[model samples]
Target: MARPVTNAAFEALLKAAGYGNAHAAFARQLNHAGRGHGTWRYDAASVYWWLRGRRPAEHVQATMTDVIGRKLGRPVAAAELGFTIAQVPATISYPTSAGHAFGAAEQLWAMLAKQLTPASSETFQSDVALQAALAWRYDLPDETVSRSRRQPVTAGDIQSLYALADHFTNLDRRHGGGSPRARALMADFLVRQLAPMLHGTYTDAVGRELMRAAATLSGQFAFMSYDAGDHRIAQHHLTIALRLAKAADDRLYGAHLLANLATQAVYLGHAQEATRLAEAAIDGAGRVPAGVRARLYTTAASAYGRLGEGRACQSALAKAERALDRATPDAGPRWVNYFSPAHFAGTALKCLSDLHLYRRALRHAPDAITLAGQNARTRALHTALIATTHARAGDIDTACGWGRELARHVADVHSARVNHRVRELTAALTPHQAMPQVNELLLALAATPPPE
Candidate 1:
């Protein structure tokens, strides 16, 4: 008998569907989806056999794909899972027209509303992301955003949307982007309110402002999705936001969105792609406000840090500092207000820490904490950074002290990024578990429930 070939593509798709080695769970999902078909009692062993080259019935394959598609917030085909059939592309392209762009945004919003779990198997696609960035950089701006259908959109409508965006921004800053209440409210706002307005008639000037406001809200949701650990959804929203920015002819904001994408890429371990996106943002954003320029530099610094390019990272950081020095309090868009001295210091700390320069990273800890203002999520993250720095520097006692402080705030913030940092701190301290303080910190973290 011939040796059976493993279904590698199917295996990869299963993992990407958030079922990492959870064969039993995948089986259960299939069973649940196939409730009307028969009394299917698939288990881990069954999944094992399937992955090893045994093909399931056609109905079973359909059920499996359907389950995976829902979890991924997009469609999946049998061929994409390695079945012998006509191949279907399971990819989303960047929208090239306003009608398509709005449709894409609406589709994403609907999917987000239906998602039950935050887990996703969607990995960052550098080619797709870079292509979008390049398009934003070189695409011709839309000359007019005017529409001649539905009710006329007014400047008052734009102002109202901006005000709503501001409200959501404050909520995200204070409670973290993973806050369930904030996410729910923002989703409703986008779907019920913003979608209709986007379809309404408007003049060229109002249409431009409308697109800018829509881009702002979409970008906010993108950041929230990233913070919530939904990388694929975040990328989708960001692509839409970048397209909207282009439609509005706001190159600076488009650059900002690219920088945001770079930040996400670095977080998801795509450091090379991140570096390229960050560079694209800087090169394309001509004569932006000082704060925006500073932000772009810091974003590049982060990507370089992740790549271990110390000289390039430092150069970017230096440029960021200089640009930040020239930033006036009211110089840039309202969004740029978040890029203050404290924010710059925090970015520097992360960059230095990524290079294993723990002592240098610790130098910025105080400023990060004191100047973090009322942003609970930022404070928690900075605390985790400080704790991890100390632990990596062999200062277990001090690291434990900071870990204890972090434990106190763990229940308050709802950010996956903050939780990730806590996990990093725990990993750094795990080696010294023999010590009482380290043991206590670990126990506390183990007991800490994820934010609701």
Candidate 2:
């Protein structure tokens, strides 16, 4: 019997078109939503409809066309897809390109604009897709030009590329990691120098590691942009990152990438798929170092928590904690440094909090708060946790007090997670909004806007 036309068959077609391998390409295509949302349980048939001009929720048009074009052996145009699909009313407002690639790219760019408020459930899937696309771009060997007439490798290029990554990395750390300007520059750099760098002259192992590092960094940029709500761009970047990581043959990064993808799926309510992705990551990265392996387990635990699998959640958390005990600070990658005691406390507490074990959540809050150090983002998160838990526990006064504290902290900075937490707590404290302290704090927060 003829083989069924599966995602695998579709992917094979993509490779024939000079794209990266299937998962890498699909991962790249999903990159339109940022890596986290890449494995989103897509409306496969609905995507076929998108080619007929119906706009589906954020990033669907781009993702569908990008993938469909590869699969169908034709130019799959978003304009030809579901632009009129009533179910996808969310992403219809923004413009699209005249055709597939351009329209997709335009949609990607529009998604990256931090200023654009999402229409509905779309969130920032576009940025992720865009970022994924770029991250995997270096894996496309034919795309890298090696003209004999090209100028000698310039010191300026190297300095610029590394500096750009470092600059955005720093800003994202302090400002909460999303930056379109950085995403654009990084995308351009990947298309330009990075692809060529992989092609130029490294040994097999060196090339693999070099591409691996680039992939990891690209995914970071993708995540930052995704956090900023540019789902289209962020997704694209992560897709690209995964593609490159696969090409680099770093099993750990690929699995790690899937862990993030699983987390996104859970957050977006795709519990079944999230569990699968998380499981894939943990199993795939089994050969990774103990420390890296721990991080993977932690990611899986969180996904399990989201799905209300309490036993699975606790088990994963235990593994994560054990990994933490075995870890040597100097052994892990610099990127994983943020996965420290404070981060552990925060994520583990969140798992507890999500499961509605409010007391357990509360117990960890103090640890999180204490270990959170001077990072304002960390502080704001812990404070929000305290405020919300208190509110949930009917401790009105304490909730209001913590709400007031968060109000002051968020006055000078903008973080969606922070903003979301503050909003949640603020809503929880609303019954006591008339209380003098709560009223005063709200007024104070409203009086000042940070310098843009």
Best by lDDT: 1
- Candidate 1, 273-321: lDDT as tens digits: 9999999999999888899999999999999999999999999999999
lDDT of each prediction vs. the true structure?
Answer: 0.82, 0.56
Clashing pairs in 1: 16-121
TM-scores of the candidates in the order shown: 0.79, 0.64
In model 2, where do residues sit more than 4 Å from their true spots? 1-164, 178-203, 370-374, 444-451
User: How many collisions between residues are there in candidate 1?
Assistant: 1
Backbone clashes for every candidate come to 1, 75
Question: What are the C-alpha RMSDs, in order, of all predicted structures?
Answer: 13.2, 12.7
Candidate 1's displacement at residue 189, Å, is 1.4
Which candidate number has the best TM-score? Answer: 1
**Local lDDT at 159 for model 2:** 49
Give candidate 1's TM-score: 0.79
